[model samples]
Target: MPPKSAHHALQLEHERERDATQGFEPKGTFGFIRYLEHGFPSSLVRWHYHDEYELHLTLESSGKVFVGDYIGQFAPGHLVLTGPRVPHNWVSIDTPEEGVELRDMVIQFAHAPLETLAGVIPEVKSILPLLHRALHGIEFFNISAQAHERFMRIRDSTGLPRFIEFLTLLGELARSSDYQLLSTIPMQSTDDDAALARISSAINFIVQNYASQFSMKELAQQLDMPERMFSRFFRSATGNSFTDFVNRLRVNKACELLMETERYVTNICYDAGFNNVANFNRRFLELKGMTPKAFRQQAQGRFGA
Candidate 1:
């Protein structure tokens, strides 16, 4: 028999081979977005990427989600928008013996047509920023009820009506503030060039210094803006309060540590910039719906570990 290390290496190689680029071409489709649904354990449930933005909604089962290099948990009502060619997969761990009948509902559309339309159609221009953010991956919260309804409408209709409903869905997602960027680095900006520059600077600083102690007041002073005003501006641009943003960065860092290292939870808490283990556990549970240890255990399933 092969050694354990050799077996694991072979397993990883096999999984990488499964991570092929899925090709899609719209055939007889009325509009840009194509709607698709499939059951758990189907051919669609693989680590893959394609040249279209995918708005994916998980309707059943709980699992670990992999987007780019981010690994996290996912459950019902989990809605994530992934940009073109950003690798992603959801491996359901809680499937029943017979498997789920319908686990995922998805809509995909290309970027070029949307960009072209935005050049002429003022209203459609609003979705540009959302598309840009999806380059990392955006997991929206609290809109699953509405999203499910819209997906059903898109699936049931044909031609222009379906296209209109799809637009409505895009508009809703673009406007929503309750979301988190999942992979790479979380970045947010506004239309104002000046504001975008300032926010970009602040985001860069935060991303670099997240492991150290810092304050919004200190950052505000550095920017020569009043604390209260800076606080509001930061929220407007990033969709998260300054403190919440820092905490999320720390939590995501902790997730990476838990997934990649064998270190103790206490050490990881401080390493991820949390001053205390209790607060680390609380924040992890609040943002992830699971404790740090639970998250680590579930993340292992992402690799078939």
Candidate 2:
């Protein structure tokens, strides 16, 4: 469990989700940047989405970062870009073997840099599609050895020069050939402003109840929609049926528990909400291309947990 003070601070941060008055109209030149240096023993979801495009640069860390439909290992020199309303989170479970740390910088920008208003501008139009692709997620490697210095410069500078330089680097990144799209599914329209609210609500439901046994019946009722309509809406919005989507979360959680805990595979399966050990094994193999034991062995070889 988190320490008392940290627990309260985290709760306060989580409560921000309850305020649904804010609209999803993309705002520009309004990104907030911050530095994060996390040591260990952290198990908080903070699984919220926003209108801002998030750029998180992992300085020196090895953990799993779940971005939209993607879940994989996150290591040093990794920079991930996620677009608006793509629910993501980083969970840090302490290692029982020696020392480990997770450190990174997160810059959340208002909407994407390319807006419909900028469609008329020839230059802006060139980069619009790339930015649109980010709605799913993007991951890049900081191959430039001087990246630390460049990051420091961006962090310390204050004013238009800094902002311009920042945009320039991002432009270079958007145009670069060395990035991977994390989610293959094209982002769907939540329709309009109300779509954002619905997406937010769905994410809230997932994060708050991932550990428990949840059914679409409850969610459909809560959203005040017919079961069929809610099911269709969810599949269209997330690119996965409700069952598959929740299974992804379960498998992701199982991966973390497998590596971080000495708990048996059967126990881990039960804890992650798997109905049976056999099913868990099958799904784990399907998604990870390995059985739970094999995955744990691999992670231990690399992370030595």
| Top candidate by lDDT | 1
Give the Å error, residue 130, model 2.
Answer: 5.6
TM-score of each: 0.58, 0.63
Error of 2 at 153 (Å): 2.0
* 118 Cα displacement, candidate 2 (Å): 12
Which residue pairs collide in model 1, if any? none
Measured with C-alpha atoms, the lDDT of residue 154 in candidate 1 is 89
For model 2, name the residue pairs that clash. none
Instruction: Give the 10-residue window scoring lowest on summed lDDT in candidate 1.
Output: 6-15
Give a tens-digit lDDT track for model 2, residues 225-278: 788998998888778888887788789889989987999999999888887899
**Which one is best on TM-score?**
2
Clashes within 3 Å, all models in order: 0, 0
